[model samples]
Structures are given as structure tokens and as C-alpha cells.
Target chain A: MRITERQFVELIRKRAPSAGGGATVAGLRHGLRQGIGDDCAVLAHTRQRDLLVTTDLFLEGIHFRREWQEPASLGHKALARGQSDIAAMGGIPRYAFLSLGLPRRTGQRWINEFLAGFLRLAAASKVVLAGGDTGSSASGFLADVVILGDVPRNQAILRSGARPGDEIWVTGTLGTAALGLAVLQTGGKLRRSHAAFQAFCYPEPRLRMGRYLRQRKLASAMIDLSDGLSIDLARLCEASGVGARIVEASLPRLAQTPLRHALHGGEDLELLFTVPPERSPELPRRLGGVPFTRIGRITLERKLWLIRDSSKIPLPILGFQHF
Target chain B: MRITERQFVELIRKRAPSAGGGATVAGLRHGLRQGIGDDCAVLAHTRQRDLLVTTDLFLEGIHFRREWQEPASLGHKALARGQSDIAAMGGIPRYAFLSLGLPRRTGQRWINEFLAGFLRLAAASKVVLAGGDTGSSASGFLADVVILGDVPRNQAILRSGARPGDEIWVTGTLGTAALGLAVLQTGGKLRRSHAAFQAFCYPEPRLRMGRYLRQRKLASAMIDLSDGLSIDLARLCEASGVGARIVEASLPRLAQTPLRHALHGGEDLELLFTVPPERSPELPRRLGGVPFTRIGRITLERKLWLIRDSSKIPLPILGFQHF
Candidate 1:
């Protein structure tokens, strides 16, 4: 019989368990502090630091076909997805926990290669693979990467901080990762050394740029472009109770690239942030020499718009959704 | 076309990206101190405390067949698996992060039921479901649960602490979950209200008992019996560089239960611990109404054995292995 989540929770609550005298640790320890419901849970942190945690799931076939991707690249992308989330929050990732569900047919050589890719990026970013679980799957592989990061206390960049008249900014090119995927899907690989090829297989998280934006107080709100600029910006507006207007000419698209790909193509892993008008000038044009561009402005209209040929056109929200 | 993990890491390391002056987080922030290789990652905690982190993976078909199992029970079991690891370390669980690789055919109704089952156990145990990742899987469902827990510094028990002459103890009954599974598998018409069924479906992690044992300094080493007594005990002995001798008759077996099931049946989330001769008197006969039994003692022989009546027999290590 199919059961509803509501009914299940209700039944459980009714049968909630209690302990005999002094058996439970109820008042003995400082347990969980925040979240049965929230985008993320919060733990009381050490002095001057706020801990940030996020988890990402990567499944074969849905995420990447194992045949087309190297085991090492799969490993790298797995950790990269979670690291990108840490970068979005302007925090430095400290530890990574990987849970891999591999099919029983997987060979030892493949397993070792996967760990190599995963651990390399971790070492580059100073992230340690702390602990993880492994299990045999009858089907394709599934991987989950949980990353723990820390930001200066109260210095976290949240998508809810965008406000009216805030200048919208983006780091790096928009469709690089998507271009890599397009090339793979179309079976039109340019070259292994090509930028698009590398971008698709091994996208770098904008860690330094996120840190710069946070430390310089250059941005009011921030999110990573994992789900494309269109949907992610819409989410930012929704979270901040505002809207946005993007200048069509300002997008940093690769030559000959479709604007739609730059707008809706996901997996870019770039930072999309909004700067309050007063802090706009303090924002650098080049952060550590990586191009940073002003792409739009936050509006109070509560509608996303694109400024094309001096005309305001409503932009469609199209981005990747795992579900 | 296969790239070794070593080669991939070396290549990535050689091409590592760089940043401009004064942009990096620098020495201002202290990062993760341990856990590149261990069952759990350790983080410096507030004063005399240390953070313990562990993750567990449960896959459809491999760990459980969803066809027969209820959604609520699946959710409860998912969190229980991770909580048991925390108990194994003598820590209190704080937050749980789940990454679910759900099939495309899964319904909202089904998803809700699963979460209901999961959250119910969380609420009872005071663990917050802080955050998680969800994605579509072409294959059957897969879930990875990561739990963050804490214990007073250096107080968390490990598998390596058993000494010769330490008395072995176990909290709760052995093979109860396996019996439940066997009943279900054989389509035996056992009453729904049976304790075996409840134990199998809603296995409780001995969090309180683990804390009690650690605080009272009774257990020299500890491990939860996720696997059967035969394999888990062997592991404990191997870790401590010692052997063990168990009186088979002392195992708390259910009436009519087969001796084989008690030795090899997995999925029991009960704590198996060791206490020195001097400290054995401090352990209680029961905690939270769960029976505590002294099953055996750590021996210097470097081999695990079981005594039945007048005969001493070598016990084969036969617990579940993930890979």
C-alpha cells in the first residue's frame, strides 16, 4: 500500500518514544541547534567563524554516462559539485565526505582512478576527504559528496540579501561547462586540450572570487550558477523578495555561442552576486585576474526582465532541476 | 583510455590554478585537522570535545528490496544506520544529511512517505535533518546518510582499544533483526506486533548506552553489531591485535532461533563493547530496559573461538563485507 509522508510523520509523532529516568541524554549534552527544516542546518561555531555544510548527489546516466567519462573525471566532478556549493556561500571548504554506491561489476582499477580524481581537487583546495561509506549497487554508480566549510562569522553570503537597485555581477564565462557537455552529447569533441573540453570535464569552482567578493564587502547577495544564470537569478530574486533586469549585451558569451546556452545552460559553476549601489565601485573588474562583469541590476518589480535593444522582455526561468 | 588515479592527480596538481596577492584566505583560518583515511573524520571541538563524522550508504536491491519494505521503515532504517556508527564511537548525533538517488518513476506520495519514516526517527533521537541532495537515478534508489556527532576529546571509543582479559559485553539481543528478516523472507505469518518484527523494522541505536559506557569508563573498545557477532567480533579482535573466546550458550538467542543466524545474521544495530576486569563491575545489567550480557573475554591467542559445552571451536569470520 502506498503511504503518504504526512501520514507517516503523523503516525510516528503519535508513537513518539520516551526514555526512563536518566536514560536519555536529553539535558546532558548540547545537541542539534538548528533545522528540521531549512535550506541548511546551522551549528554553533567556534569564535569568529560560521560553519557551512552542503551535500550534492551525482548519479550515473542522470548526471554523466560512465562510458563517456573517465573514472578520474567522474571523481573530480563529484567533489567539484559540493565544493561549488561551499564557494557559493563564500566559505573555505575544510573537509569532504564521499559516499559511493558502485555496481558490483566495477573493477579495482576503476575504483582507484576515481579516488585519484576526487582527492586531487581536494588537495588543491585544501579539502580533506575525512570519512565516507561505500556500498555495492546492482546498477550504475551513485556518489554523494558532503562538504564542510567555514566563513568569517556573520560574513556568509546568502541568496536572500539582494535588494532594490543592487548591481548584479557574474564571475567567469557562463556557458563554458555546458559547451563541454554539448560537445560530448553531439559527439563533436573539439580537442582534449580545448578550453570547452576541460571546462566540461573538470570545471573549477570560483573559490577565490567568492572569497574576494565577501572579504571586500563587494556583494550583497550570492549564488553559484550551477542551474544556469536564468533560473538561479530567479531563485535569488525569489529569496530576496525582489526582481532582476539583465543587459543582453553584457553577458560574457564565447564567440559563436548561442545566447540561450549562455542563459539557460547549467553546470557553469560561476558566482552570480548582487552589489548594493554604494558598494558597486569597490568591486573589482578583475578578481585575481579572472574577469568579473556587471550583468544586471536588482529591481523591486518582482519580475525577471532582460534588456534587449532597449526593450524590457520578460525572461523565462529555465534551469536544471534534479527531480 | 583509462587514466590512473595517481596520474590524474599528478596532472591536476601540475596544472593547479593560482591567485593574486592578498586574495587567498591565508593563515588566518585554521582548517580540518584529521580524517583523510579513517572510519570518521575528527575536528577540533570546543575545549575537551572532538567532532566525529561518519557516513553510510543504503542501496535498493543490495541493502533492501523496496518492494516488500514499507517506506516509513526505509526512512527510519536509513538514519538508524548512521546513528549506529555514532553510537559505535560513543558520540551524540547532532545533524543528518541525506543524499537520495531516486528513480524517475518514484511518486511524490512515495517520496513523502520515505521522508516521513526518516524524520520520525530523527525527531525521536533529537537529530535534525539539516540538509540533503536529491537527484533522479535511472536505476533503483540509493541513499547515503552522513551524520555529525561529538564526544568529549579522546573519549570516543575505537575498535583498537581492546586489551587481553577485557570482558566482552553486548547491549540488547543478537540476531533479532535477522530473525525479523528471515520471517519476512520466508513469508512466515508472524504477528505484526512481534518484537522481532519491530526490532528489524525500527532498529534502535544504543546512543544512551554508548554514552553511559564511555562516561563511566567501562568499555575499553566498542563497535556496533551491524554485521553478525562472528564477523564483528573478529574485526574487533583484529583491530586490537588480540583474539576472543565466547561462550556460545551465553548469547541471548530467541527461543527456536538457529545458532547460525545468531553468528552471521547482519543488520543488528546493537553495541558490542569490552571492559577491563577492574571496570567490569561498573557496567549496568541493563540500560534503557535493554538487556546487557557478558558474552566473552578478550584473549591473547590471536584467534577468535567459541566454546559450546565442553568443546572449543574456532569461529570463522563471516560478517557482511561491502565490497
Candidate 2:
């Protein structure tokens, strides 16, 4: 059996000292506030702000197929993924560093469109392109995007902050992106206006909602749903040393989407977070035009479960696993 | 004609706003102090220290061949390359974020050896592996390392700081790395004790020397010789809006190495810096056991020339071009 990405990360974490583990340079104290297991590595920047750094690898054929998506869409997704990490940390994305490896046959026009798409979002998000390295790839194109963001000092929402009594909530409808991919896989047109197509191609990170939740101190724990609900929730619970039980009927999805898609599909780029029972009443039904759905609650036992029509069943931890 | 990496960078620079070009986040006055066209992106971290960030991509088949080097050497070089960028900036590397994409056939043993090599150098350099992302590669293995370092505010040396009449100095023997590569290409056995082999396999970044030069205010500008002498010098000159004339006789190289390897060969990873004539006397001939040689001087004319046997000739800007 192949080792999962989580296991690999654990291997690294065990081998490499934690960032905040009292690393010193010339007897001066300088260390990351948070590292590895979180969405973004948090570094103490200034007295006023903490820096959030997140790197995402967007590899060709593995992460996306060139034939299925346009170069512009690829560019957008590349930056969006990292921004979602920042959003999950309740941070504001500021600068982006992109290391790109272009294949031999790539043209100047393709690069221009890619930059156009990337810069369009950067401009909208107020993130500046800082610096990066470029190389000639032997095979397909690859891009690793590093997003730097800022959050109030010691105020970042973490996956380990969830308590057993916290209720789990999510922003936007689930599984729409997987449905879009399903259509694309079956050779359907990418209708730009369609919600499913839009969700897959031009998926937006829940930056505003995350910031609002953090500012209001409403969320106890947060993570972006880049993977499926089941796996990402598993990660959050694992980090918190707790489990979760979600209601199947409360899961939000389009009419055409199967329950499996909502439960196990990936790349939705929505915000999944937990709130204390007392804070749940103050949680908005909608924020920044995105619907918020409450479908789960953290559990004391270390097991994932789904309540379907009053019947409790184990929830399969199925999502995209790179191994 | 294929577009050169520099041209592609220029295209990006023109398309995206410069990092320091008044980028605002929520009306806050935060921006990068330096961005593209440098060894590292400089960001204002605190009143006492500035942060330096540099990302380097090491692609399989492009940067190195699997058969030519061990997985450990590959890992060492990957981290070393980014550390060299930090060294070139006269900064102390504090943290590293590695995004790795492993091919399908990669085994656990290979990964363990790679991390051993990477972590060894990281321990020596006092760099903590803060965070990273991992994925499965469809083709060749790829790794991109992002290094974060710190320097005294406004004290980090830059390629743009060179001025006319400045003496150009370099550390260690040039072209030894290329010699090692040539030996490898010719099916020669790798002798670990050989300087050339060592140079190519695990080139040491001039971190201590760079810090000494900066602390003493001896270097006006600095750059790393990752690309060959001719091209890297040209880049430094271009960034500084000046030119250079190097004496071929003064180039430091092994007795067995040809001059062409010093002039046109790449991946030496030595520090190439500019010191004013008045400050040259104060510069050490050797620092931290590495020899330093004065080979050139900044010129008023904006042209690169090689002074060989008292005759001047154009220095062909021939180095590694990844286009």
C-alpha cells in the first residue's frame, strides 16, 4: 500500500523540529508561531501582525489536465488554492511568489494569458507578485505558488481549536465542483454561467467570510474544503483530538449532485469551520452572498459518523489522496 | 526564436505591478521592500530585521539526472541552492518550505535518504523546515524550496548597489563544479574527496563570508555565481546599470580546469561581489577557509569585457538559459 500524504507530512514533522521549537540565530529568538500541520505556517513578523505562509504544488496531469481546462483557468486555480489556505487561517493574502516550470512547447501567448488570469485575481485580492524562479520542465508544466498573508498577532483560527461541543458549519454548497468535473469528464461543454462549471473552473476562496468570522471571534476552528467534507473534517477532528457526527440531510448540494459527491468530492474550495453552541445563534445564514450550512457537531469519541434518517453509520474518509 | 528566461521575467514584470509599487491591503501601508530582478524578495518584517525570501525549482532531468547524483545529493543541492540565494543577499537563513512532487516509483528509502541530506545541511545552517506541500508527480520528481532569512533592516546587499570603480571579487575556485559534471558525463567514478566532485555535489553557500562582508560594510553589491561567470556578472552589471571588465589572468580555478569552464560553465555557487577600491584593502583575501580573488572592476561603460593578455574582448553572455 502507498503511504498517504498525511503520513508523509507526519514523517517530516517528526524528522524536522517544529518551527516554534526554540530555534535561535546568534542567540536571538526567531521562530515560526505555527508550522507543518496547519493550513499556513505562521511566523511572527511584527508586533502588530503575524505572517502566514502557504505553498501549493499545482502539477500538470496530476492536479489538472491541460485538455480539460484552459491555461487561464489553470493559472486561477493555482493561486486560488494557496489563497484558500490563507482564508482557512483567517488571514488576508498579501504577496504571492510563484515558481514556474514550463514545458518546451509552451508559447508566449499561453504565458500571457496565464499571467492575466493570475494578476486579475491578485489585483482583486490586493496581493502583489513578489519574486520567484523559472525553469524549463522536461515534462508537463508545473507551478508552486507561495502565498504570504497577514493576520492579527496570535489570533489565527487553527484546526486544533475545536472543542467537543462545537458545531461544524460550512460555507457555500458542496459537491458542485465535482459535478462540474463529472460533466467535463463525459465531454460536455464548460458553460461559464453554470454554477457547477463556475465552481470547478473559477472557484473562489471564502476569504471575506473567514475574515469576518475571525474578526467577530465566531469560529473556534477552521479549514478550507479543498478535499472532501469527510476527509477534511477528519483532518480537523484529528488535529483537535476529537471526532464528528454529521447529518446527511443537512448536507448542502445541488439537486443534480449525488450524496456521495457532497460527502466525498474534492476541490470545492469552501470554508469548513466549527463554532461553539452559544456562538451558533449569532452565526449568519448568509455572509457575502454565500450560504452557511450547519450539518455537523464535534464528538468526544475519536470516530467519524453520519446520522442518516436517525440511523448512525460510519462516515468513510474518502477524498483525493496523493500517494 | 525561443524567449529567454530574462525576457519572460520582463514580460511578467511588465504585466504585474511591482511588489513595492504602492500595493495596499485594506488601506494599510504594507509593501515589499524589494521584489523581482533580485536574488531574493525583501519584505519589511520588523523595525530591526528585514525578511528575505527566495524560491528555487529543482526539476528532474532539467536540473540534474537521477543516475548522475544520489537522492541525498539531490536533496542537499535543492536546499543549498536556496541557501545560496540567501547568502547572496547577506542574510541569515532561518526557515525553509519545501514543496515536493514524487514520481510514482519513488520509494520510502529514497525519501528518507533525501531528507537526511536536506536536514543535515539545514541543521548546519540553522534553518528549520517550517512547512511544505507534497503531491504525486505524473512524470519526473520535482522540488521547489522557499527560504526565509533575516538581515538588519536596510543592510542586505543587492545586485543594484554596485557602482563604477568598484572592484569585483569572487570566492572559491570557479569552474570546478562544471569539471565535476564533465567527469560525470564522461563516466568517471565520483571521488567524494575530489574538490570538483564536492563542488558539484554539495556546494557550500558563502553564508558566513557574506555576513562578514556586510557587517564590515566591505561589499557594495553581491551576487551568486549559479549561472556562469560571464552571464551572472552581466546580470549584476545590468541590475546596477554598470558594466565590468574582468582580467582572465586573475580568475581563480583549478590547474586542471580550462578557462572556458570558469567563464561559461554554471553552478559554481560562489559569491560574486563588488567592493569599492577604497574598501578593497579591508576585504579579506580568505574568509572561513574560502579563497577570494579580485578578477574585475565596475566600469562606467555599460558593456562586459574580458581583459586577456592586455587585450579586451567581448565577454559572450553564454551561461545556462532555460528557454
Candidate 3:
């Protein structure tokens, strides 16, 4: 039957009689000061601390082809993908909610295997699977994970925190996931020295490293390496009202790989940050075994540039875009 | 390329750093008590009031057909569907997180319109849209909503609360949504008095009435009427370790429709509850304008019966089931 949005909404209102009880409680509407309408859900856990809550959808055929990946890997990667945003905000993940839209035909064994992979990772990170909803889908599988984390009332490290003098640093390697993607697409065999295949299938979230940077007051700004470094770096620069320049020799490229992959590839799930030169010295060279490298510095030119040998060239901002 | 669940999960662990400092200070570790290995995401909010969290996915072809619905109605219904579960638990909803997977080709207008409908209802109910992640899908639309709510440690209700000899009561009219569905399918006109069309499209959650019942010590057991009366009632009975018997004539069926709709139709979003006979007289015939009907009584027979006209027969348990 043809149903207009209004008619559908009216039907919902008819069903919802138990909403809005918080009007009776004072000071309870912090992050939700704007109420419920917006692109992102805002919440106030404390006066200065706003808890931002959001979920991401990863459908089997739509986001990944199941035939190429194992169930456990799919589950773990899904959670990591969501947590990357939390790391970008310099927040610590406290709770995770997973909603699975399973195809009825999928075997129970597949689900068990998937959970085995997800739970192992969750246990290691001390992330709780707080709650989730389940339903059956007609064809492809879908996983929507909602992660809840908190930042200090005013200390949230936003993409907008960088300044012209801030130095940029990236934790661990970059472009491995992207390179892994290329390898997978070309049906190439995995080389022992090149772990890009693993990087592609399962990307890690640098939660501890992010928290360390935030807690120690080291980073002026931070973002995770999900989209390619160039695009994501551009986003941080744009948010911070600045630009950036990178020394080609300073970048921590994956061993035995093309520099192009490291520059343009994505899904590294590493922490990228900017710090004042003075604070950069205080930052650790490694965080929880992940290597740290000083790649570049933020600049006022409002353009992203790459330096190689002696020539400085413009770095194109290219990465994944859903739209 | 090929990724195993184990390898995928390992990738997540490699990326996530250890939880430190503020994460420890906030006592956030308590949130992940379940450790993530189960079918459901386990969370313990309070020793006395443990929170059960779950999420559901609704896709275009999987949950509903786009040809039969408007974007606004779909949005509203989505929120209402999740809230109904909270109501069933006798809990007050505090926040909601939505993850939407839209087809890249879907118009921006559709997204805005959908959010407008969703937010309107959310605002009225004081349900804050806390946070969400967005991604583009290649095929149909997908929406996943995660809701958080609380119940008093001592007063929290569950489906397992009903007992033999408790009188069964249903709040509001039933079968309207089911009838509306039939109308949509048959292109049949609905009587002005029917109002089932609206009921089917938008089902109201009886949150206030639920709170009142809990606060006033009214119900011994309670559940929301999402599935059909027979099906939901049976569930309540099964959970409570009891059975029920209804005077078929006393069942609150909508005016001018098939009895089957009231008996077997779903998505009513009403409250099916039981109260001791001593408290029955104090219960109102209507709570906040919604009518209440005394439909049946809980019995020890371990069977559900419907009495119609002069004969009584066992009622068949039929309702929507995803599995």
C-alpha cells in the first residue's frame, strides 16, 4: 500500500505513548540540548563533556564481499572501523553495541565463528558489547555497530585543533590496508615480508595511542588513518584552519613497498596527530609497540605539499568518499 | 583478498592500544562486563538494574517494501519499533543511536525528509539521537537504531513477571495495525471509525502508562503488543511460567473488521499486562485517552483459550517471526 511519510509518522505517534519523561528531570538534557534532530546524535555526560553517539552500517555485498573474507575477520574489522572515529576524537571507547542483520540462510557455524573473532578482540581491548538488536535480512548480511566513548568536557581533540605551527606525526605504518586491497583485487599472492594482506583484512584501532596523546597533552589535533593519508590529512588541515607539508624521507612507509601506496592508500587505522614542536620531543617514539614517526608540520599556506629529493610538489587529496 | 575471521580480529587487536588513564578513571570497564563472546551484547548497568541492550536492522526489501511506505513513516516507525521493546520492559528510554545505510543514488531530499520524520517523533519523546555513523550502500536502504533506557532497580519489569491467577489486561485498541495492513494489501477502504490504517502505519508506545503502572504497583507482568495478541500473550505466559484464558467477547477488537486481524495481526504497540484482582478496580478504563480492556485472566491450565459466542476453543499462536 502507498503510505506517505506523514501517514507513516502518524502511525508511529499512535504507537509511542511513553516518550519524553525527562522533562520531569532537570539538567539531564546535556548532549541532547538540541533535542534529537541532526546529522549526529549529541549527548551530555557532564557539563563540559558531551558524549557523541553514532553508529555505522557495514553490509556484506554493499561494504565488503563475504567471499573474500572470513566471518571472524569481518566482525573484527567492523568494530575497528567504528572505533577509528572514537580514536580520531581522542576519546576512549567504553561500550560497543552491535546490531546484526543476518541472512536467514547463513549457517549457525558462520555466526559462531564471527562472534569468536569479535569477542576475542573485544576482550583484549576491554571493550564491552553493551547491547544490540538482531533481525533477519533477505540477502546480504549487515552489521551496524554503535560505540560509546567519552572525552574531557572541553578537552576533546577535534579535527579542528591543529594550528599553523603544529607538527604532524603518524603512528605505525600507512597504506597497508590500501595496498592489501590492491593485492586482493589483483589476486596476487601474499609475500612474507609484506603484511599488507593482514592489514587489509583486519585494520587495528590505535585507541591507547590516541588516549596517551590526549592525556599527556601532546597532540594539538588528531585523526585516525582510515581514508588515505592525503585525504584525511587534508580534512584535519581544513578543520584546523591550516595546511600541511610532508618530508618524503620522514614518512614511515611500509618496508618493501612503493611510496605511492603509503601516500595514497587508506585503511591503515593508525593515529595521526599534530603537536607543537616543543611537545613533539616529549612524545614517545613508540606507543604500545607501535612505531611513531614525525612526517611533517602544519603550515599557513592552506595547501598540502610533498617534498622529495629536493623538489616540493602538490599532494593530491584523494581517498574514499561515500557520496 | 581472503581474510579469516581470526586474522581480521587479530588486525583489530594490533591496532587498538591498551585502555589507560581516563578510561580507567571513568570506571568504563564496567560497561563491557559481558566480554563480547555471546549471541547478545551483555551489559550490566546496575547490580539491581541490569540493562539488556539489543539492536534490529530494517532494510527496504527485508523489513518493508519501499513501494508500500513513505520515508517519513518509515523513519517514525523505525524509532517506534525499538521504543516498543523498552516499553515492554517497563523502562524509560533515555537515548537512541541510529546507523543509516542509504543507497548512494538516493536523493539528499529523501534523507532530509526521513530525518525530519524521525527527529520530530524523537523530540516529542525526549529521546536524544546520541550518535551515529553513516555509509553509502550499493543496493537498498538500511536503518539500525540502538536505544538506551533505565528502570528502577527494584521496580524493573520483565516478561517473566506474570503468574497464574493474575488478571490479563490490554491497553488501547488492538487489530488496527493489522487491519491497516490488510487494507493496504487489498486496496480496501477503511471506515472512518476504523482508524486501523493510521494504527498500522504509526503505532504509539505506551511509555507513560507503563511508567504509571510500574510506579503505582499495578501490573504483576507486562509486555508490549507488537506481535499479535495471541502470539505476544503466549510469550508472556511462557516467560512467566503461566497460561491464560480469554473471554473471546471481552477481547478488545476494533470495530468493523475481521476477528482474525485482532487475534493474529501484529504491530499494535499496545500494552498487554496482568494485575492482581485486588488492584483491578483501581485501574482506569483509559489511561491518557487510550482505552483499556479486561480481556482475560491468567490460569494454571498451561493453555490459551478464546471464548466466542457460546463455545470456547484453544487459540492458535500465530505472529511475525524472523527466524
- Candidate that would win on DockQ: 2
Arranged by DockQ, best first: 2, 1, 3
lDDT (C-alpha) at residue A202 in model 1: 86
On DockQ, the stronger of 2 and 3 is 2
Candidate 3's C-alpha runs over 4 A off are A1-28, A32-42, A46-52, A151-154, A191-194, B1-26, B31-54, B151-154, B189-194, B300-303, B307-312
Regions of model 2 farther than 4 Å from truth: A21-29, B19-29
**DockQ per model, Cα:** 0.39, 0.61, 0.33
TM per candidate: 0.90, 0.97, 0.84
The stretch of ten residues in a row with the least summed lDDT in candidate 3 chain B is B18-27
lDDT of 2 by residue, A235-286 (tens): 9999999999999999999999999999999999999999999989998899
Q: Pick the candidate with the highest TM-score.
A: 2
**What TM-score does the predicted chain A of each candidate obtain versus native chain A?**
0.88, 0.96, 0.84
Distance from true location, Cα of A213 in model 2, Å: 1.1
Docking class of 1: acceptable
Report, for every candidate in turn, its global Cα lDDT versus the true structure: 0.77, 0.89, 0.70
User: Which stretches in model 1 have alpha-carbon errors above 4 Å?
Assistant: A1-41, B1-39
